[model samples]
Structure formats: C-alpha cells, structure tokens
Target: MGTPEVSRSPTKSPLTVSTSLTETVDGFHEFKIRSYSLTKGLGVGKFVASETFNVGDYTWAIYFYPDGKSPEDNSSYVSLFIALASEGADVRALFELTLVDQSGNGKHKVHSHFGRALESGPYTLKYRGSMW
Candidate 1:
C-alpha cells in the first residue's frame, strides 16, 4: 500500500492549553421508557416522542422508532434521535445513548458522538435543530 497522506489545515491544527475550554456537568437525568417494545407496530418512518425532560438550560426529548427512520432501511434497524425542545441557537453539548441488554448480563450496546475529533470543537446545533 502507498504511504498515507496527511493534510494540514488552518482551522484544525491541534488542541492546546490556551485554546481549550472545560465544562463540568454535575449530574445527568435518566428517562427510561418502560414500554419500548410496544413501538414496533408503528408504521414505517414513524416515531414516538418521550416525555420532555430538562437537562442544563434546554428541554430535550428522545424520539424513537421501532422501524428505521429512513425509507431505505426497510425497517431492519431501530432509529433513535435526541431533539431539542427549548430555544437558543448554536447549542454545544455531548451525548451518549446506550441500549441495555435484558439477558441479565452487563453487556450493552453503546453509541455516542463524543470522543471524536471535532474539527471546530463540539458540534454547534443550529437554532432549534431537529433530529440531532
């Protein structure tokens, strides 16, 4: 294989002490949906909204669909998304979603947007962005 090439960009140089910002979250909220299985009957591309919960200064909800969110998937996979309920633009945040296993074991499926190289730092949500 040929040697890999690395690109040096202006905006994305490297993280340094002076250009870093730290945020500490005291705690988090766990909103469990008991009847998650019942959503399977929902039509394709359909989703059910969870009760609104407060986190930090904004209200948020979890949108879950037993079928896939897009038509191309043909309902093979479940689609999940977090949406902003409150206002204010350019919201920067970190989030993690886990699917717990029911086999009486500790293993669980995890998906997250954190721990990745954020070119301009954490993602900036547009004013009331949907399907985040």
Candidate 2:
C-alpha cells in the first residue's frame, strides 16, 4: 500500500509590515500597505495589504492588533484587524478582518479564511515609512 500522506502547519511565522503614501480623492491621503511573511524551510511565505486606505494628511500611521482564539478543542488561531486615525481626529476607523493560509507554507495571508475579529475597539497606532 502507498504510504499515507501527512499534513502539517506552521508553528511560528515571521511577519513583515510595509506602508506607502498616496494621494486620494477629497484631499485625503491614501495609504497602501503590504505585509510579508518569511519562512526558512518554505522560502518566501505570504504577503497581506489593504487595497487602498483613506486618511487625513495629519495621520501618522496605522495599527494592527492580533487576538488569539481557540475555535476547536485544541486548535488555535490568531485574529487581526485595523484601526486608523490622525493625531487630531477624534474618530477612528475599524473593520472586520480575515486571513487565510492558501499555499499551506505554515504562513497566513489576508483572505477568505484563517482568522477574524469579532468586534472593534480602540487600538494604538504605529507607522513605518520604509522597508528594511
């Protein structure tokens, strides 16, 4: 008989965060973001980013907070979402988020499956202009 195939998942993955500044309609700044995941054995893993973001010129950065959850008895996953605002604006931006592991490289990408946020809350914002 053929050997049974076994499957495994990533135990820990390296995450990279990237950001860009662009011009948007209504005199707002459009921030383009791209996040990368690097893996040793599987090579370059995954990348996630927003399609387009709208913010005020005074806005300094974007923040992403990840929450941990256990859906099954022992299976656990990480949930994530975004919060955005300017230094002076009293209002902030919040949205539902989801991630998926399409390539199965033990890395997760923002997609239809994987993890999601159940609610929203105030989050501290951090900004990085260049990639290292």
* Best-performing candidate as measured by TM-score: 1
Best by lDDT: 1
Candidate 1 has its poorest 10 consecutive residues by lDDT at 114-123
lDDT by residue (tens digit), candidate 1, 1-132: 999999967787587665667664533556565677787768778987778887777777888777888888688888777777778745676677666765559887766752454343555566674555
Report the CA-based lDDT of candidate 2 relative to the real structure. Answer: 0.35
Show model 2 residue runs off by greater than 4 Å: 1-52, 55-76, 92-94, 104-132
Clashing pairs in 1: none
Among residues 3 or more apart in sequence or in different chains, the pairs in candidate 2 whose N, CA or C atoms overlap within 3 Å are 99-113
**Candidate 1, number of clashes:** 0
Q: Tell me the spans in candidate 1 whose CA falls farther than 4 Å from its real position.
A: 1-27, 114-121
